[model samples]
Target: MTYSKTWQGFYELLDTVYRTGRPFAARALPIRLGDEEADRAIDLLYQPLRDGEGAVTGIFVGGYDVTEQVRSQAALRDSEDRYRTLLDSLDVGFCILEMKFDEADRAIDYRIAEANPAFARQTGADVAGLWVSEFAPDLERHWFDTYGRVALTGEPIHFENQADVFGRWFDVRALRIGEPAQAKVAVFFSDISDRKRMEEALRVLNASLEAQVAERTAERDQIWQASTDLFCVATLDGRLASLNPAWTTLLGWGEGELLGRPFLDFVHPDDVAATTAAAAGLARGEPQPNFENRYRHRDGSYRWLSWNAVPRNGRIYATVRDVTAVRAQAAALAEVEEALRQSQKMEAVGQLTGGVAHDFNNLLTIIRSSVDFLRRPELPEARKRRYLDAVSDTVDRAAKLTGQLLAFARRQALSPAVFDVGEKVRGVADMVDTVTGARVRVVVAVPDHPCFVRADLSQFETALINMAVNARDAMDGEGTLTLTLTCGTAMPPIRGHAGSQNAFAAISLADTGPGVPPDLIGRIFEPFFTTKEVGRGTGLGLSQVFGFAKQSGGDVDVTSSPGRGATFTLYLPEAPAALEADDRSAAAASVSPIGAGESVLVVEDNIEVGRFCTQILQDLGYRTTWATNAEEALERLGPDGAGFDVVFSDVVMPGMGGLALAHELRRRMPTLPVVLASGYSHVLAQDDAHGFELLHKPYSAEQLGHILRRVTRPGRPRRTA
Candidate 1:
């Protein structure tokens, strides 16, 4: 063939081909089949020629009838390129494994085209065209068997297999690359070590979390069971659903008795309304801050209950506190406080009476003595009768006035005796209905058996009546009044210690009425303190009970809150059968006249008292001396004066009180008899009878005579008779 290329251009093209070392093709624009043809056909291709030294020599137009062969070669090259690209780009380890049946059906051969980076890194060896048994001997059986199955059956196999290669792992699949047993089987493998590590880590974390939850659950159970506060779960319908040990213990009920039962079954009837309201609020998801109510115990006694709860897990989880003991203590404390306040008021009143009595006794002494001298039997009988009548009138007026003062002071001369308390409770109950009118129901639950206490019968009845009256006032003649009398072991004194433990009776007066006024409730027991109109009450009822109870080794208590009625309880020492029945004979009889040869010393700050005492002593056949105060008495008993046989001194003189003078006088005349005279009971100091004779003043000449005879006469017992 002839070519148009110049010699230099031809050599240049040849150099280019030789330098690049790649195939190149070119084509002409068109070809014409004319009759005249050239001596050669041109080949539009570039090629390089090499010389003996292996250097590129020249471009050559070496034409031949090789069109068919050229097309075939080009096609082969294109397929080879595609195959090489696939081998390089694949991620799975592609090994063209050949199964073999040797001496045993085990040994295998591996003629890999090329392995990916994954397979190369796993084995740490370039393993193309390697025997399968030599490269990985342990995998010979499994690999050949899997490869054989897939290659022969034209099926794909997916399974897990392990390899002890770099970063050891499990591989997933084996499949045939081509059709039939003659073809290479592809075994695809991946390093799954990282995935396995992640799974193991997750398992350990789950175990730890489960352990933590178990521990927390155990702790919660322990708290629920061991706590003193009752822990419980209730349904929305206010049924007792579940409870801990504390609930049963506190309520004194068995588990069977409480579970699935309505909570209201155990509530105090009077408190049910408020409890129902609180439960309703809780059901509506209201956060009730510590709800308070009362629950009836198994013994039919009511106890206070306080509770707080939360709604969670479709149930009400709650903590209940049996505040009965605390409530009782608080009630007892309030009662004690009320009693103490009342007692203080009574003491204050007594102090006022004492001051008045100190002055009044002197005046009474003068009058009594003048009246006594007028009846000396030296005058006519008619005139003497008139004088005696006048004396009688004076005595009657004085007795009435003194009685009022004693009532106000709460320390009248009471003769306490062993008797049934149930009668008094009933007596008060009978009057309660009359006083409270038809609007109130009065129930007297007095015990049929004797519930006994040692209290003055009159005072006891009066206290009961007072409480009933107060209840009537509170109810405004409406609602129910319950007077309950029961006996029990002695409780600690409602106030201070009332001796040691003693048999006691509890008289409870409960009223369903308007509660005490919130503001004035605390001060109701103050002297002259009243909730009624001026004519209705003197306000000394509670105060008198307070003093009388304490003095008799007992206490009085009361409770009232807003919107709730009032309850008053009296706790008194039970009279013992062994003790003398309150010495009733002592309550009777007037003061006795003085016997012969008793010398008396009269000490007073008031002029009228001193002079009268002198006259009475002389009239009673006793030598008498008078002194204005303790100082004057001490001087009169000094070396200049002959000492009297007995010293009669008035407490509360100008310079010193009677106790101090007694201390002073007893220093010199320790054995000499001294009697302290006062108009009122001794409410000044803790003890008015501290190692001396105490004479309640406002006594007649006859009383003066008795005091002297009782002290001065030998082998004589002390008595007013």
Candidate 2:
């Protein structure tokens, strides 16, 4: 009879029958059992069937699960094929165990069910169907415990051993083959010796790498300590974080003393603002160029430092070099530059003076002649008075012109002494209120403490007032003038010259005026250059201030931009003195009576000036001789020319200047009195009675007499020609 089940399933059902009375037909279908190992089917075919007539009849039919019997046979054959496949194809070792019972009905041993050839390689045993514990007695204590547990529990147990086994590490997995009550367990193992050895090697390598890192770190620390430059780290707010030993050695501060202090505390107080700003910028990730500033050393003195700063990883890193010597050299360079500039300026002025005097003296000659002719008794008193007044006014104009020239040339003399600049500025504040009209507001920002400077008191005050007036004009007489005194003790050297050292004190005069035109700022201090209309300004105001400051051993600088108002800085070298109002000069408003008598020697390259000088002296009742040059004057003094009472020489001439002549005369005659006349500052400074008395040019008859009197009368002595 045909069954509606697979052949294997039909066989499985037949195996279950014990007292079956009939044969049956069944249906069968295929079913999977193990991965690539077995298959099964089920069917209802079993025993034989009988008919009612007592003879065998048609067999009974039923659908049955016959999958297992068919599958079992297939599996056995497949297992043999797999056994060969595993032996040739698997990379890892494989083993199988079979159950063996003892005579008392207890499992006493286990046999090799079937194993691929690799099992022999794992263990040197060739015998099949034998107990693993017996074959390898060394594994009895080890593998037996896990094997028995698995065999009874029907669960898998996996183990690993990096210890050399058969010359290599091995990992094994064991499991029971049947139910929990089974005595057979299969164990599989593989070799992983290479991975284990590699791991151990890597651990050693990591330890070596750590040691090398430590060595490198020590070397780097040694190098850092040996370096000469000062390296430091600070917070964004300029609080010191870390510093090298060099900082303490060079700066005289102990490490512990420097820590937790504001980095700017070690900086000169005046430089704190700049240092703070730079640090803040660095903290915000902005790099700083090598900027010069002042820092306080362990001693109570300040020194220069130049440094570059950058912020890295939330910390400020700065490398600094002591720049005090460099700064000093730079200051010296600046002084040299200033000297050169002054020399060139003086040369130009001297040339201008010579040219002007040569040309203008001829005109003066005619004017003097006309005036002399008019002074005769024939002319009416009214016309005579008018002519006299006209001549006097013309002479005054010439004098004023010369004075302006002197201001430009910086030749005008200044009586210098120490004075308090703060009080001087304050004194001007009250005057500014009236000069600039009530509409203008003036505030003096002078410090309470004394700020002393060595300079010409009148000139300094005059320069400051001039600056204020200019500021007031810029503001149309309605703005503020703030005079602030700032200490410049630690200012960096300027213009690479020690002489160009920033003044010890700075008096800044600022105004809220419409700012100066950028184009005019540079030229404002030039003589006769002005922004005001023709009639409004002489343009000599700033030139005078500039000349005065330079002559007084100081400088003037201006900062201005369109719409930003303006500030004028008067940098005056400091002197130890009280910073209060100083006394005014006693001769400030003196009439200065002219001198009479005494023989005079006048040297003028221009014939007209020579004659004018001779005539003026003669009219004043003094003996005199005129020379066109130094050579002619020397001859006059040597007895061939007229005997001289006192020598007066023009600075610029065809042969030699008055300064050189004066020095030569000082050597020749020793006590021979000489006077130097110039319209330029270079001439005046060239010899400050390093040889003879200095006299500025463009003098009137009265001025000429006055200087002569002052020179002739030393300690109240006088002479008559």
Clash pairs of candidate 1? 1-40, 678-697
Residues 1-721, candidate 1: write the lDDT tens digits. 2334343255565656878865455543122224435322234577666789877666655434444444444544543443333334333354556555445443354556445565686567888767656666666355566666676676766655556444466555555543463555655565566542110000000012322433333423533453455656688788988777776666678888889999999888888898888878778877455788887767777768777665543566565656566677788999999999899868877855664575357547756875877868687888777777766666665654454346445555554557777776777667667767888788889767777776667777767777787888878877888888778656554434543466678888898876877687666655446678865765666666666666666777777877889888888877654344544235323335665765566888889888887887788888777788888788877742254677788887777776687777777767677888876545432343565766655677776676667666666432220
> Cα deviation in Å at residue 354, candidate 1?
19
All models, RMSD in angstroms: 34.6, 32.8
TM-score of each: 0.36, 0.42
lDDT tens digits by residue: candidate 2, 185-252: 65556666654211100000001232243333342344345434576767777788978777887789
RMSD of 1: 34.6
List residue ranges in candidate 2 displaced over 4 A.
Answer: 1-438, 441-462, 485-503, 517-529, 538-540, 547-553, 560-564, 575-596, 639-644, 685-691, 714-721
lDDT values for all models: 0.63, 0.65
Model 1, which residues run further than 4 Å from truth?
Answer: 1-485, 489-504, 509-520, 550-554, 559-567, 573-597, 615-623, 631-646, 654-656, 660-673, 679-685, 691-693, 697-721
* Candidate 1 global lDDT: 0.63
Best by lDDT: 2
